[model samples]
Target: MDELVVRTEVYADPETVYEFLLDFRGYAHYSEYLREVRTVSGDGGPGTRYALTFAWWKLTYTAHSEVTGVEPPERIDWEITKDIDAGGCWRVTPSEEADGDADDGSRCEVSLEVEFDPGSASPDALDLPRLVSFDWVLKKAIPLIRGEAERVVERAVRDLEESTRDVDLEVYVDSDRI
Candidate 1:
């Protein structure tokens, strides 16, 4: 299993960022790969479970997630219980330059952790690259998977900035690293 981490800064307090992530439904508008997410049980805190669906062109995959941990204004983490071995998290804190509810200075970092072997039983990983599809990815899917995943996350950050109007969310994408 390989792990990839990509982070972006948002001009919102830790709590605000936390809230945004807590509402999984709002993420549908963020990435094309994400179809929609709905709560299956409990509040969004730890132990909460969600029914999530994602797609790449003609291929679609569904999975259930149980939030494993939550630390308000700091971090939140969850584990995927089906289809794939994956996890996600967000880390928020006061930006060094910003204080109070000014919105301009406060920032939070978002990260997603994925651990899946291409040789795994599921075809979800190979089908993630809409253009590359299963055959090419199955042959050597690492680069293709990583690139597509990064693009998905990048789009999410861009969408998050556009939706977050109360603050100037400056999201930085690292093209050099995915």
Candidate 2:
């Protein structure tokens, strides 16, 4: 089993960040490698299932996943059910300095653990010899995951900003009409 942990500060509120993380279908809008996402069962609540595909190394791998835990505006955890044995979590913590007096920002952390069976497929499946010789794959994968998480955080912030802007414009228009 290989584990990767990434932590970063996002310039968005905790609630907003948490909500974005739980929006499984929106992952492709943020994750650079995720090519597609679809809800398979349930309603994105705990135990909801989803299918995700990632485009990397000129190959697309699909994984079935289920939400393992969810706590609004705080934490969410998920486990992969097919293709690979993996799990991940997203955590949001309030950032006093970035938020100023409004509590508008948070520090986000994402962690992932994945284990692949080198013997499951052909000898060339994962280039096992290369992995043993140079540790190339895991090294590359960790940084990729970190960058993806960062991008997701940025996307969440942008989404929140756009939503707020839209709401403010609506309020202004309504006030003028009244």
Candidate 3:
């Protein structure tokens, strides 16, 4: 088993970042490797499950995931249960500026650990000897995953900002009643 960790900081509030990450359906908009995503069971909170289909080596494979932990506007973790070898977490918190202002923006980090089985009875075959010789598979996949995660976060932040730009907050104020 091989493990890799990748982290990135996104410019957004914890709540906005957390909400975007929780919505698996939004992955297709940002994740370069993910071709399609479908929710198989439950909503996006803890215990939610989804089927993620991605292209690997010009072929597509589906994986099942269940949310293991969920703390609103803070952190979320998920476990891969079928057709894949990975678990991941998304963490969000205020920046260290001491202002406690999410509107000023914050940061978020995402990490994943994956293990590939060389002896599994699966369609994809692992070249054990080559892996031992050069460790190419691990080396290649980690960077790819890291890049995809970064792209996803970047697109989500941009989308969030654009969606909120046209809202008018003054409409909520009732001057006559006051």
Candidate 4:
């Protein structure tokens, strides 16, 4: 399994950040490779399913995921239900700077963690050209997938910070293979 941990401090209340993450439909806007996100079932809560379409180079694939857990103003968890074996969680917590004062739109720490195994992912969902082989595409794409999570999180943090407030933000990323 490969894991990615991205942490950032945003100038927004915990609930606001949590609500942003809960809205999965907006996720496609954070990454260029992510073409679209369509709700497949349920509401924007636990048990909600989403189909995320990703396009890169000459390949396009749609992955399905389901919301597994939701804790208001604190956490949201989800798991990939099709194509790939993966799960992730978004955590929002009040920052030390916003402990007691500045209740209205205070600062919060946001973290996203994802664990995925490319070897466990099926290539059947990949839309490939007629002559291309799955093995060749997978060999090339797996390496890119390792770094994709980091890129997405980096963009998410920057965009979230910009959208919420005009503040300079720093994103910390840690990746490991388990």
Candidate 5:
């Protein structure tokens, strides 16, 4: 039930960011933690399911994700179906200054939320030592408690930049999955 929220301003329009968020197939290309991501059903909107396999803390997790909500060029929410109960959303909007020129590439701000406990779903799992808490291992690896989300956001941004670079500019800005 723990939650971490991250917000970042990118050099892209809100629409561009929204469409990019809809492209689930590009996750593995963006974050190394995401070992694989493929559509299981639907497209990128509500009911669209995705099979996601990722590694964290030397363990691999496989989960099914479903898009739960979509508001177009603004917000998209999702829910996890198996493995772990976790989901987050992308909120895209023009920055204050960009309000006057919404299409300017640098005016968009994106907020990402990632909520997860990172522990086994079974209650008995926590009874075993070194089985339920991520605090210890993460602290040893990071100096600050909030650093994990920062790292996630940093890597996500870098991945987005890299993925966009490989695509035609117009595609990222126009095509939903290009």
Candidate 6:
């Protein structure tokens, strides 16, 4: 399995960031390929199911997922149920400045972490268009998927900062491979 982690520090508190991350629907706007995130069942909490549609060029796939875990004001976890074997988590925590003191809830670090094995999922179940093989699509998409993870977090940070305050905030994206 390959893991990707994207992080950024926000001028908002942990609760604020947590609430923003809790709403999975907003994620569709963060990535260009992500067309929609529709709720299938339950609320935003654990047990909620979602259909996340991603489209690029002539390819479109709707991946099913379920909210597997949630910790208020801190974290949310989900597992993909169809077309792929993947899981991800959103983490929000108070940021500690250089002086080793927490920012008194004024600033926090927000992170999105995902784990997936490109080869683990079977292509037989995929609904591919005529003359388009799943292997061909995977070869072309694997690289884009990695970059998409980074792009999503970068956009999410910018949107969150813009929504929190009127003034523009500096955006810094820290990406890690694990």
Error of 6 at 113 (Å): 0.7
lDDT of each: 0.63, 0.60, 0.60, 0.77, 0.64, 0.79
Q: Lowest summed lDDT over 10 consecutive residues: which window, candidate 2?
A: 168-177
Q: Which ranges in model 2 have alpha carbons more than 4 Å from their true place? A: 97-143, 161-178
Worst 10 residues of 5 by lDDT: 169-178
Top of the candidates by lDDT: 6
Error of 1 at 71 (Å): 0.9
Per-residue error (Å), model 3, residue 151: 2.1
lDDT of 1 by residue, 68-112 (tens): 998886788888877566676765655564454544545666665
On lDDT, the stronger of 3 and 5 is 5
- In terms of TM-score, how similar is model 3 to the real structure? 0.65
Find the 10 residues in a row with the least total lDDT in model 4. Answer: 169-178
TM-score of each: 0.68, 0.63, 0.65, 0.81, 0.67, 0.87
Pairs that collide in candidate 1 are: none
Clashing pairs in 3: none
- Candidate 3 regions with alpha-carbon error over 4 angstroms: 1-5, 98-143, 163-178
Please provide, for model 5 over 7-90, each residue's C-alpha lDDT reduced to its tens digit, 9 standing for 90 to 100: 776666677778987888776765656788989989798999998776665656566889999999999899887655678887
| lDDT of the structure predicted as candidate 5 | 0.64
Which residue ranges in model 6 land beyond 4 Å of their true spot? 163-178
lDDT of 6 by residue, 1-178 (tens): 7777767777777888888888899998889899999999988999999999889878778889999999989899999987678898988878897999766788887878888877777787567889998888877777676668777777777787776333322333332322
Model 4, span 1-178: residue lDDT tens: 7776666677767887888889899888777688999999998798999999988888777888999999998999999998778998998988763365645557787877878877787767776799998888777766675456556656666666676433333434343332
Leading candidate by TM-score: 6
Off by over 4 Å in 4: 98-105, 163-178
Quality of model 6 by C-alpha lDDT: 0.79
What are the clashing pairs of model 2? none
What TM-score number comes out for model 2? 0.63
